[model samples]
Target: MAEKVVMAMSGGVDSSVGAYLLKKQGYDVIGVTMQIWQDEKRCDIEDKGGCCGLSAVEDARKVCADLDIPFYVFNFKQIFKDKVINYFIDEYYLGRTPNPCIACNKHVKWEALLARALFMEAQYIATGHYAKITELKNGRYALQMDFNNPKDQTYALYGLTQFQLKHTLMPLSGIEKDEVRSIAKEIGLKVFNKPDSQEICFISDNNYGGFIEEEGGKKILPGNFVNTDGDIIGKHKGIVHYTVGQRKGLGIAFGKPMFVKEINPLTNEVVLSENKELFSEGLMASDINYMAVESVKEPMEAYAKIRYSHKPVLSEITAQGENILCKFKESQRAVTPGQAAVFYDKDGNILCGGVIERAV
Candidate 1:
């Protein structure tokens, strides 16, 4: 009997073509679209942005039909809200920046969806992420970055559990975006030309402040913008409205340009300074997960990325209990808290990753 695999299709060319590729590899692929969000005001899922909604269901179904595979819609609204949306809001409220996509990947997609896939007797769950999952000789799974592929997604996937990695397959690893789209076009998938989702799916307007307010009745509040010297500069709309490294939309101008260097939720102050002040020697990260190795008992040298689009930098990582301290060889700019800090080896293998706690 052929091994069954569940392909998480997002109504985009990447996932659509990914399903076809897996099926051609002789596996029994079943396509699934996860319905993660729905709001009366933000209902433009059919338009070229974000995943989820009924349109995603329809588009994914059509692709499955073309591939001769079964397709299903998995409702993840509650879990998404609980894990991703709530975490995002709470992080901002705490004056820390959070990556909701990482939360969604860890909770909704892999943890919850993978459980359902296992229930369906599928041996593996796959996505269109441009990262490779390989098993090392030490009997562990590790994620590798494709240096040649510009669309590398290994950063967002570093938080995945070992079990999730072992049961996961990413066929799009090292494949360029253009090549994937070309395959979709050749296969005649209708979503071949669909634009990639840019904004957060639930926030159609890209106004995170508005979304936080609408979903509020939570602790989002207005505060004072201050300088690093603890002197008041201006009034901020709210802590959620501003992030570290933000220069525009401050509504107040200094003699020269000023950037937000820190957000202190306790004092309800947004610390502003010159752009040069954003540079940091190192950062401390909590909630760490290791992939390339079993554990990090001693300090190690590796390349680390603070954000998805950030280039990996040479750094030294030392594990301290539940957290890891990453000291960079060179000064890094805007090392914001609550974002992910993913470490990679020389060959681009994910060594470990965690949520950045502070810039030290």
Candidate 2:
């Protein structure tokens, strides 16, 4: 008998194609869609970018029908609100930025969805994530870099544990985005030409401050903007409205352009400084998950990316008990707290990653 594989279909072209590929591989393919949130209209079908949205479930259903597979919709709204959305709000409230996608992948897709797949007797759980898993000779699983486009590689997947990597499948790991779209078109999938969801699904607009204010029910008070010398130059709408390295929307006209150096939540102050202050030589991180190797007992040389869009820079990483220290070869700019710092080997294998604690 063929092994049963459950595919998390998001009603997107990539996941739709993933379902097709699994069925063609002769596996007992089962398509599962997670209903994670209720829409503003309280309708079963909404256009929200969340995977659990009604439209996505319908899309997955359509693909499953075409593939002659069974379809299931699991409601994960309460879990999503407690784990992902609440965590995001708490992080922002604490004056730290959080990546909801990372939390969603860690807690929702891997933990919750995988559990559901197992309950259904699935041998493997697959997704459209552009990542690869390799079994090494040492009898360990390694999450390798995607072969499609280096720029599109999601090194954030370093958080994946060996157990999860063992049963996880990424169909789009080797195929480029263009080719995936082409395949979807050839297969006559409805979402073949659909644009990728870029914004945080819960937030209809990108107004994070507005979301916080509406949810928290606390009006952000106006505060003073001070320079490095402790001189107040202008007034800011609120500390929550600014972030490190923010240049525009300051609403102040200085002789030269000034950028947000830091936000002091304690004092409700937004500090403006010259661009030079934004660059830092090193950082301390915690809440780390090491995948490629067992643990880092000493300092090891590797490439590190401070932000998602930034290129990886040469760095030496030292494990300090529960914390890790990353010393960059060159000064990196705007190393924001709460963002993850992912390490990689020269060959692009994910070493590990953690949340930024502080920058030096």
Per-residue lDDT of 1-360 in model 1, one digit per residue for the tens? 889999999988899988999999999999999988656358577674457777777888999999899999999899999999999988888888889999999998899999999999999999988889988878888999888877899999998989999899898987899999999999889889988987788778788887887785675677898899999999998898888899999999899999999998898899999999999999999999999897888999999899998999999999888889999999999998999999998988899999999999
CA lDDT, every model vs. true structure: 0.89, 0.81
Count clashing pairs, candidate 2: 0
Report the lDDT tens digits of candidate 2 across residue range 1-360: 999988988888888888888788788888888888757443223444445577778878998898789999888888898898888877776677788888888888888988889898888899887777777666777777653475354655667888888888877777777888899899888788776765677776677777777776677888899998889999988766667788988899998989987777888788888898889999999999987777889889988887778888999999988888999999999888888899888767778899997787
Location of the lowest summed lDDT over 10 successive residues in candidate 1: 40-49
- Looking at model 1, the pairs that clash are none
Candidate 2 has a TM-score of 0.94
Residue 2 alpha-carbon offset, candidate 1, angstroms: 0.8
Best by lDDT: 1
In candidate 1, residue 143 scores what lDDT?
94
Error of 2 at 352 (Å): 0.9
